[model samples]
Target: MPNQTTFTIKLETELKDAFTKIAETEHCSVSQVMRDLMQQYIERHEYKHFLEDKVTSARASIANGQSIPHQDAKAIFKTRREKV
Candidate 1:
């Protein structure tokens, strides 16, 4: 891979062994596996933060009683769509 930065990471002995075995089985280097895992980890971390924000917004709306009943909401949307 071009334009890639390298870094050293410490892993538990057992975890290192497992990663090495997986790399061998997948016909790739441990470094490649770690890179893929890190990418997935970062993506999940970002998505988690987004979900947290959404949860917080929902909680605030509930606390402020700024919500309509679910059935009323659906009916309103249906009427709006029909008008559109």
Candidate 2:
């Protein structure tokens, strides 16, 4: 956590207590659990958005008639795979 900054969030007392209890049970700080959860959430959404962007670009390419034939694409892929 070099170059770390403090972050604050509001939560209900009960929820905070529950989180604290779980953190103690696991012998880790609440911050660690929250960081892990946040990291997972960020990764999941980023991957989802990346796929969405790819689909949109593919759709645009098709709309503009800028795509190779399926067979041609497959042959290119096979050739490249063999070269590896």
Candidate 3:
């Protein structure tokens, strides 16, 4: 296991109680639940930015006339699949 660190977080009493119940139901500590949720939030935020960049790149490619028509692309892919 990696080194662990302890920190304090302030939560509303209702939220804390609800999360404690959730942790108990899941058979894990509140810290584990918070860690998992934080990790998921980070991953999803990163993926959102990744997709935004890809969309921007694709728009630039289209503007620069570097993309094929959708029908042409479909035909190319179909031919390749048939050859296999």
Candidate 4:
């Protein structure tokens, strides 16, 4: 098994109660549900960063006159597709 650590958080009683009820309805432990939620949040955060980096790179390429025109790129892809 992987090494594990405990995390602590504070929330309102009503919020905790509602969350616990939902977790029970789903037949999942509170800890497991929290873990799943944390993983999803992390995945979304990382993907946001990935897209930001891609946009920055694309902008830099355009500024440096290194990007091909749309029609030329489309023609190139069309020829490649026909070769397959």
Please write out the lDDT profile of model 4 over residues 4-81, one tens digit for every residue: 999999999999999999999999999999999999999999999999999999999999999999999999999999
Model 3 lDDT, full chain set: 0.94
Candidate 2 lDDT over residue span 1-84, tens digit each: 778778899999999999999999999998899999999999999999999999999999999999999999999999999999
Model 1 segments more than 4 A misplaced: 70-84
Report, for every candidate in turn, its global Cα lDDT versus the true structure: 0.92, 0.96, 0.94, 0.98
Question: Of 2 and 3, which scores higher on lDDT?
Answer: 2
Off by over 4 Å in 4: 70-84
Pairs clashing within candidate 2: none
For residues 1-84, write the lDDT of model 1, one tens digit per residue: 768787987879998888799899989997888788889999999999999999999989989999888999999999999999
User: Looking at model 2, which ten-residue stretch has the lowest summed lDDT?
Assistant: 1-10
**Which number leads on lDDT?**
4
TM-score of 2: 0.68
Write down the RMSD of all candidates, one decimal each: 3.6, 3.4, 2.1, 2.1
Give TM-scores for every candidate, taking all chains together and pairing residue i with residue i.
0.67, 0.68, 0.80, 0.80
Q: Candidate 1: TM-score?
A: 0.67
